[model samples]
Target: MKYQEFFSITIEHSYFSGGPADLIVYPEEKTRKLLEKQGFLLKRTGTGIKVLLPMRDNNRVFPVLTADDLFAFHVLPTSGTVREFTDISEIEEDNMILFTNEGLDIGTIELIKSETVKEEVFQNFPALAKIEIKGNQITTDVIGTPPVYKAIFDSKSIKWKYYLLSKSGATDIAVETRGDQLQFNELEIGNNSLDPIITSLRLNFPDTKIAVFESSVAIPLSSKSIKDIKLIQRDSVTQTDSILMKHLPNPSIYDQGIQIIKIK
Candidate 1:
């Protein structure tokens, strides 16, 4: 019910191959509460209380603020811990989840990043709404609807969605009629992590038609499911419906980047 329940800040670095901290700890009141719910309990020390993992017969000693030293934000190996900071001090991260409202038992959560409430995102569609949560309360600064980076009208929307979602950050894009005045309409959210290259992507999906929009997302031709794909242009480039038979590392794009794959 608290803001801390839905969000935590942590920095992720893939370069830490050497010895890393078993935990990245920034013990806050809300964080402590969550940990308690996760089976951590306080033991009476000589002078005060200390957060420790519930003792197991195996003598597994879990660490915390008073337990041990820790790194920024690495998985706990056997398990993972949340990395909440007192301030936004980290500079970089990859595919980190800032906030999520899943399993909250609430229908909708209006998250206002600014100081004044303006709009609420409903099912990825921005709409006017009231800002009220169970225990989370904050201000917001919303000038208007999210700005659209690029648009694809009645016949061209996938390219913009396909392109913007491929990158990180909230793509401030709008899909609407031609207006140089820079007005925006409804918007949509994208995947949390950037899509991987088609080749590196595991074809664990059903044997059905899959649409892969042409962005920088690439794949290899190792899978027999993908014999050869054609490149079609939907972006506002030199051609609207240009087609070219190309293989991996060169396929421009197809209509919505449709790849007919019969995954084995």
Candidate 2:
């Protein structure tokens, strides 16, 4: 299998609400070959290739590479009758992928920014490999027998940030500015639950607006000021199953999956 067979990139039509292309594009032969090796059927009409629907029955057409996506795939189109192909010259420099292995396979895919690889083949890589899939991005390092936790707080200026005495699991926190208020967009608790992280964050930034993502009813927190907490239902069909297939081995440390919370 070629290096590119280990992965494919996709974005939903919602990603581009402006317009759709009119060209009968075929993802340059190399890209088509790679995707086909991975079980993707490149639908061909009598005279032209057709676009496949984006996953999850989305309205957007996916797999059509822009200049940047082509650079990430490290392919240049030779000659094509297609009117909407991504020209190699238009590719952004930063969009190029740097693979650890010469023949980029699943175990050697270098995670850069927000990119995904074949989930089923991901476990062959080291446990410490940083992986970003769906809304979750995790990287782990071994410490003692169990892994220690590293807290990632998302804020411009947290009152007083403190390093963790011990690490637990990889945690993700995202905050976005909402007018004058700092809205905690999302929080994925570590393996140890919300107590430790919440305590530490509260200690650092006492009274700040925050929100937690939760599936069930809100659990009362000691901080009465954290009343902005919002309860959200978990996706009935989550990408977790795809990313964390039982066949794929997890790191030694326990993972708390993800959770949400809010404070104001």
Candidate topping TM-score = 1
Instruction: List candidate 2 segments past 4 Å from native.
Output: 1-28, 36-39, 42-111, 114-179, 182-264
Q: For residues 1-264, could you state the per-residue lDDT of candidate 2 as single tens digits?
A: 111121323211111233222212234445556455433454443222322323434322224333322211211112232112122122243332121222222332233332223222112321111121211111122321211111111111112111222122223322222241323334444545556766666566554433343222211111112222222223345522111111111111012323222311
Output the lDDT of residue 61, model 1.
35
Stretches off by above 4 angstroms in model 1 are 1-30, 33-106, 114-229, 232-243, 247-264
Per model, how many backbone clashes are there? 15, 14
lDDT of 2: 0.26
**C-alpha displacement of 81 in model 1, angstroms?**
19
TM-score of 2: 0.16
